[model samples]
Target: MYEQFTKPILDYSIALVMFLLLSPVILLVSILLAISHRGNPFFLQERPGKDGKIFQIIKFKTMRDLTDVNGKQLSDYERLTLMGKIVRKTSLDEIPQLLNVLKGEMSLVGPRPLLPEYWTLYSEEQRRRHDVKPGITGWAQINGRNALSWEEKFRYDLEYVDKISPRMDAKIVLVTLEKVVKRHGVNANNYMTMEAFKGNVA
Candidate 1:
């Protein structure tokens, strides 16, 4: 009952309310990102959502388009500006994704939407994460976020897929708040952000 009807209703309602309440902060961050990037403040990229469907995920532009003399884009650490790091650390960069939830492309809680390029890499079991709508925060997010290994994160994603309930969702939300408050696990081990997931090896 909850997964079929109640969860969607709650997701939409809560997303709307949160977006309305956080509009001021969103606008402020957008302005800051615009100044930092010298242009658009929103970053839009195609990500695989539920059922492996593609949707453009929106996030605040936390990095600038900095290029090396060779005309290649710099690494994430180098492109990440001071304001970008601050917004990312505080998680203000995720505010734009509330619109994704409002648009029905995401949930407030579920497996996070990952890059479309990774579609071919997920094994049959790992691909189960796409069975439900992706989320802004999930079981893996609350557990360790970028700090966890890819295999561990996929394990949590599948676990959440097996157990989708209001109780589980509530617990994830509460823990997420704690994580953000403490600014924990925003970066992967030794990387400014998570290292790209190379295909799992045998």
Candidate 2:
């Protein structure tokens, strides 16, 4: 009931209100990011949505297009700037994804979408995580985010799919807020984010 109806309504309202209230902050961040990264303020990447449909996920650009002497792209740690780090730690980088929620491409709570290429690697059970719209934050995110192993994260995601309820969603939102406020689990220890999934468990 909530997931199909009320959540969407509430998500839309929140998206609109947040976008309006944060416009000034977003604009300021955009200016700083443009000067710092010398490109658009936002980043967009294709991620699989419900039922494996594709959609463009949006966020504030936090990494530079830095290259090595051989002209190869740099790693996340290499490209992540100090200002970018601040944006990421504060989760200000995710503000743009509110537009994604507004567009019906995301929800306020569900499994965080992964790269499309990962679709091939997911087991049938793991793939069930996409049964609902992807979220800005989710059970997996609130649990440990980058701190959890890929296996654990997927388990949490599947659990969310099985037991989604307004009460559960509300709990996830609260825990996510607390985690972000403390800047906890912003990055995996010694890694910019979780290591890329390599289908190692297969």
Per-residue CA lDDT of model 2 for 63-153, tens digit only, reads 9888999999899999998879999999999889999999999998899989999999888888999899999999989889999999999
Per-residue lDDT, model 1, residue 52, is 97
Query: Which candidate leads the pack in TM-score?
Result: 1
Give candidate 1's error at residue 14 in angstroms: 0.3
* Model 1: per-residue Cα lDDT at residue 190: 70
Tell me the tens digit of each residue's lDDT in model 1 across 66-140.
899999989999999899999999998888999999999999999989999999999999999999999999999
**Candidate topping lDDT:** 1
Determine which window of 10 residues in candidate 2 has minimal summed lDDT.
Answer: 193-202
In candidate 2 the C-alpha lDDT for residue 71 amounts to 98
lDDT of each: 0.93, 0.92
**What global local distance difference test value does model 1 have?**
0.93
Residue 96 CA displacement from its true place in model 2, Å = 0.4
